[model samples]
Target: MTTTGAVLRIQLLGPVRAWRDGAETALGPPKQRAVLSLLASRPGDVMGVENIVDAVWGSDVPRTAVNGVHTYVAGLRRALEPGRAGRSSGAVLTSESGGYCLRVDPADVDVTLFHRALHAARRSRGQGEAGAALRLYGQALSYWRGEALSAVPGPFATMERDRLRDLRLTVVEEWAADMLAAGHHAELVTELPAAVSEEPLREKLRWLLILALYRSGRRAHALWLYEETRDLLARELGIEPGADLRTLHEHILTGHPELLAPGAGSPLPVYPGGLPPGTPGPVRLPPVGRDFVGRTEELARLEEVMRGESARGGPTTPVVVVGGTAGVGKTALVLQLAHRLVDRFPDGQLYADLRGADPERGPASAAHALEQLLGGLGVDGARVPADSAARTALYRSLLRGRRVLVVLDDAHSAEQVRPLIPRGPSGVLATSRRYLGELAARDGARLETVGPLTAREGTRLLAMLSGRRLDERGPAAERLVALCGGLPLPLRVVAQWLAANPGAPLGALLEQHPALRTRFGPAEAADGVPTGQFHVIETS
Candidate 1:
């Protein structure tokens, strides 16, 4: 953990340690440190007792191992959160069925921060944000103090040490690649020699160093280093230089114009985060189904509101909230609308899974969501303000004067999405199970409720999922819709069940999947329809 003002900071990138209010708290013996490191390795996940035991003691079963793990966790909890009292839920560590979890935020763990920064840097570099990529990559590489998990004793810590070191080297290599593309040949000429000496046979660094040297007008020295690498490989591994290094050597000899500029004048035209360049790159909207059924009126209404008018399309509205219960297909409708209207917003598109009501991760904090949004817009993670207020300001500044579409999906509340809303001509489309009344009242967000798909739409979806023409599907399709209560998720599941069994009737297919059958089974009139599962509907 980097620790600007966080209440607690834990570091596993170098050693197992804790700090609170500028003081290092004592973590007991080797076993206790190993347990904390293992739990921190999977922050927020419940590490099963058996898994922790295997990590700590290996296959040697001690009768006291489980009891020992319990004792260590008790000690860790006390040290991690001293404010919490006896028999109460500790803020840092908590017990769950059959095991325990260290419920610390990823921002408070150096390991998690490194991984996040490295991935974002890769994405930024992919999108031709050379300067932004370098900053992110540099921030990611800053977390390595020494060998990871150096103070913790166990197979898990030992393995993690090697893995983290290897990861750091890879990030360094990637950073070199970006630097070369950005015309940093002279800088590399100075920075790469020590790294080469440390890992003499790492071909990527060698290739990069050779290119950097050649580009820096040191042809004689570059040729000498190539021979040096070749000799090292031949001496240690008894193999010739691989094709990549050889190709680079040839390119340097011939003065390939490709090496003249960053990204080889081949800035990945694609938007960062995998959205194709011409489309809204930030939007997380899923692919729309080709056989998407109705919602004709609903789609029109959404498009109209997004255009800043009523259904008539006149005035300027900055936000649109699509509200629906579990399986009314609000997300699908919004995604389809975004894809349809993407060309209108030439600036970009942004999407976020707010994880509202998520069973595993719970509701995502707005600050975390904003960081992702900011990164996608070419802001460095380290440069992202630590406070939510400043982060929100920066996000809005990036979106100002640009016409973009921001989709906040599965939002838990207006407060979560409030800071994320665009304050410009760039419009937003948000989906939630609740109506988000505050948005309508405070932000002038137009709300549209998505109801269960009409029976016809559900029938069409079933036939499409089953790989049969809608007209050719059996009469049982309508009956299946009744069984599904016109909900798209369960109906889609039933369609898969049918596709799996050739010539199987829909009713017969239900028998094969007891769980799906339980949910999709015809409901008694007196018992009423089940409220259904919000978690599965949103997540699945």
Candidate 2:
């Protein structure tokens, strides 16, 4: 006989809910909730009748409590297995050994999924793939909608709640590390302060904020972060910063090169070839540009920086900065570089859009980026600090010695990218529309400017994208290149339009679509290319 796929799920940690399939089952009485909570905690593990009685009644057990417990268990079994309530399928709650056990898969329990994600994220870190590891951790922590067992009552719920809370702190530490790896230092400045306030005992988080402050060029603020964290740790935990944190503070105070070093941080965890436990399914990247072309010189420069060795020796990685005008292929070049360097940074590569120059809202704060990065690192929500300084310090500490590639895409300026710089010997690549002159002068950074592709390059790119032999198309291909302004972005956009409208003739497309003319405006327009298409083409 085929077994029913039905399983009981209790969520007391957040809002309380119990269900089998789409049907709701009433968990009768206070004791019934308690019984369910107990079984849920140790699903598949048999609990003796006496242990269940004590867990429910504690020291206030009554003479007839045994009979009441049995009645409650029987009712729960019926409610859980409504279809097999009276059948001999022996499913739902099963009789085992001396007592009974809830025979349910660990994934059926929310707590189990949460723990599995956390563990898997940790394992990813162990494998030196910090970027993938952080994402897994964040996915796992997101499963929690609210407090653990929020609807459940009794001692069992209370105990499990505390345990999950403790696990949250470890998650926070991992998250801080990931943010630092991802180059979100400026954003962390705002968040670390709040994190420290919320988690006063976590000295590691305070150190993270300090590092963020220092790297963001707020030397005083960075120092202040250390002082505040030190004070809080002393008053609350009656302890001092851990060895790693203390060392980081000294490095900051003495102006250690490692503090200013590119990608100087711990290696984040890596994904181990499967969806983290409890995830609905595999996480997939969204569809981005496919007809990407040109920017070869820019890509080569980024590749050199990513592969360059640290001058200070001891496995130091180089830092490369790419700056240019809007629509100049900065993002494209960096992304391409990241893909190429994937094998080198086996720990995994991380990318974040800093939005430094956004006209509307200010650039994303370092703290916010840190929070997201930390979440990716498997740091639990409850454990993440409310203070920015703590978060940065924790971030730096985590990166003390790991090889990972971090790409900070669309940065506004050097300050925005500073604190987010990792410390160890890993690689860091940043792209921005504005020139970060000071960063190059002060930090020994290599700046590469990306402009329009060469004519030959543009024609080659068009031919490759069109999937037709350029030699065969000859003049037609040249006309198409002339129509694109030699700008990769526009070329790719036009190429995609062509690929999608395969049946349409090129001459007809050029005649009907005003964008084709506008894209190659007067500045770069060839003698015969139209300008109206440039105006018509929407480049969002």
- Among the numbered candidates, top lDDT falls to 1
For each candidate, the alpha-carbon lDDT, in order, equals: 0.74, 0.65
TM-score for model 2? 0.45
Model 2 residue 304 CA deviation (Å) reads: 2.6
Native-vs-model 2 lDDT? 0.65
- Tens-digit per-residue lDDT, 159-212, candidate 2: 777777667656766776677767777777775676577567766777777777
Cα error, residue 467 of model 2, in Å, equals 4.5
Q: List the residue pairs that clash in candidate 1.
A: 181-262, 282-350, 282-351, 283-349, 283-350, 284-351, 308-315, 309-314
